[model samples]
Target: MNFNIEPISTQIEEALQQKIDTKTKPLGSLGKLETIALKIGKIQDTLSPALNKPAILVCAADHGITQEGISPFPQEVTFQMVMNFLGGGAAINVFTQQNNIELVLADTGVNFDFEKHPSLLDYKIAKGTKNFASEAAMTIAQCEQAMQNGAAITEKLHANGTNIIGFGEMGIGNTTAAAALLTAYTNIDAKDAAGAGTGLDEKGIAHKAEVIAKAIAKQGIPNSPLEILATYGGFEIATICGAMLKAAELKMIVMVDGFIVTAAFLAASKINVTIADYALFCHKSNEKGHALMLDHLNAEPILDLGMRLGEGTGNAVAYPVIKSAVQFLNNMSSFADAGVATEK
Candidate 1:
């Protein structure tokens, strides 16, 4: 389908200058907002960037490695957490509602069977992926299907006029899986990428790293992101990666969530460099490897409230700043129009 990165337009730069001049504050007074508005304007290729019909798509799945005791939470937590999201009790739900964002929960690979939960979108690939510690986590076909699911979801959201989309994940032990994927993709030591997922203890963290190292050593590094993803990635991570790419193709602003979602974005960016331009990093997560990962990607997070809870919390919390960026650009009037003296 010729997925290529679109270049920022000069019109966006000109519009940004005009918009900033219109605000009560001096031009470029709002440092980050100016940058953000310009970036958004460039992304939408419009002088007027509007974040209409914003949606947070949370992909949920269960990691087979949860059985290995890598995470403090149980695998069942994946479905339970999805239920929590459906119940509108999650941090994501609260923030999404506050921001008037539509929330979508996709069952990518959660193990439990759900009986038609109205709020839940049933796109389950399987009960869950197989154990990667012993073998490949998902087959190539499974990986492809997950990607398609993600693309379809993004396409649906885009068709519904979703201008800004946030990516979140719900899965037990996903950070462990994401860390392992990062270690393999970046060729760093798994120990360095490992984190205290769901509050793992020292011993548990060590064991998790050891297990990841062993798995990576056995599988060997793959030639591409697809192969690597098929080998170690949870369905939720894989889906998020696909969503990032699709969002970029559709020219939508992609707000990345915490560590795992960032990892997914990294994987997608590796496959396509233009993906980085479309992504707005939400925050630097408290996950152990998130800061280093962000540094490696050369990404500046929009906020740093020390958020660690996944489920798109960072993206949701950072919505106000995004809203302000759009609001300032669209609603503010120019100095000449306001009869204000321009500081020459």
Candidate 2:
């Protein structure tokens, strides 16, 4: 997918105000939902910004370092969550169903073997990525391939009239991986990036930080973001970065999920700074590193319910607010037509 710079436009903001004043409710009564509508309108360049064919792309993979017990959950949990996603039992499933959003699954680098499920997209890069402590987590070629897989998915969505796209991830030990990447990319100490991923204990958190520090030390090379990702990133993270780049190139409104998703965006933004203009942070994850990451990105998230269950749950939760925004903008009438007072 092309990663060309996208020019920002303000035409839709004018249309947004016209619709907001016409709503039956007093102006600005809806608070954030109104902001959301205006934001979508501006991105889509329409007064009536509809999220027709909204899609959640859930990318799943496994981190080889789960063997080191940095995460409280076992490695098998990765496969279990994938099953939950497929069975419609997960939070993302319910939210998408409620919002009528389409869902797609990409096996970016999971270790488990599975038959063809109707929703699963087979784009596996390897059985799983290598443990970053041992060597580079993925070769540069693998990183590019994962990115291409993400771009391919977006191309299909763009053609199918998907106006908005949100990204989610499923992988054990990934938060640890994200923390490491953030430390490298943002120049934060490994301790700052290290968090209670999957409820790690005091000792586990310390171990996570120490191990990440060692990984960084061992890397020994200049801290380029792409090199950091290729050295220590998860397959899913690479794919998500690719998706963000492609989404910007396509000029589609991007709904960015939590910390890990932001880590991917951070990596991609290093490659092309313009992608940030097309992104809407869905919510802040409760993961410890998330707020710091958002601060670095200067992102104002749509929700802040202290959620951290990475399967795009935050994105799903934020969808209604987006829908309400579009609904108000489309259904509200002009003040002149409604016989309401204008800003005379």
Clashes of each: 0, 0
Best prediction by TM-score? 1
Candidate 2, 144-231: lDDT as tens digits:
8999889889989999998789999999999988998888888888888999988988888999999888888987545566777888
TM-score of each: 0.95, 0.93
lDDT per residue for candidate 1 within 69-119, as digits (tens), equals 898877888888888898889898999899888889999999998889778
Q: By summed lDDT, which 10 consecutive residues of candidate 1 come out lowest?
A: 1-10
Off by over 4 Å in 2: 11-29, 221-223, 342-344
Deviation from truth (RMSD, Å), model 2: 2.0
Query: For every candidate structure, what is the RMSD over all alpha carbons to the true structure, in angstroms?
Result: 1.7, 2.0
* Top-lDDT structure, candidate number: 1
For residue 214, what is the lDDT in candidate 1?
Answer: 91
